[model samples]
Target: MATALQAVEVIRDLRHSFNIGRLQMCRADEWLNALLAERIDSGEKRSLRSSGGRKKLQKH
Candidate 1:
């Protein structure tokens, strides 16, 4: 499993790649979810957006 910091780095890199058109949106989403799964649960996804949560380890 990747550490939360590593997951954040992976997410940032994937977003950068997508912005550069090197990665399609679908592929970027897949990669992000895959990396995030190492730390985040599916149920926490909504809270991340809804609550404006920045830290991955924060409560949902």
Candidate 2:
């Protein structure tokens, strides 16, 4: 029946749109995670440098 075919088409379209939105969200999450990782890495490096300086000063 035409009505059944139309219903199927609508469902297919909705599923396709949902998948696209999901993919976009996944990409955004990846970008945010990468950004956070970079910030954490830099913070660790800064802390290490400061700690090393303190150790040297204490020894002297």
Candidate 3:
């Protein structure tokens, strides 16, 4: 049926869009990590709070 075909097309489009969005998120996370790595100091301790939880990167 025509209606069923249309529904399939819409679902395909949505899946493609979701994949693109996930790729963008991965790139953004990589960029942010690179930026953070540059500002961290070897002598001091700091916590990086992200979506999962807080992680201790260094010790004072």
Better of 1 and 2 by TM-score: 2
lDDT of 3 by residue, 35-58 (tens): 456435532224233211122322
Q: Which lDDT values do the candidates have, in the order given?
A: 0.57, 0.50, 0.44
- In TM-score terms, which candidate is top? 2
The true-versus-predicted C-alpha distance at residue 4 of model 3, in Å, is 47
Question: Each prediction's TM-score against the native?
Answer: 0.32, 0.39, 0.35
Q: Ten consecutive residues with minimal summed lDDT in candidate 1?
A: 51-60
Candidate 1 residues 1-60, lDDT tens each? 444445567767867776745456567667657755643565655545444445654443
Which ranges of candidate 2 are over 4 A from the true structure? 1-20, 44-60
Question: Which of candidates 2 and 3 reaches a greater TM-score?
Answer: 2
The model with the greatest lDDT is 1
Query: After superposing candidate 3, which stretches have Cα over 4 Å from the reference?
Result: 1-20, 41-60
Q: List the residue pairs that clash in candidate 2.
A: none
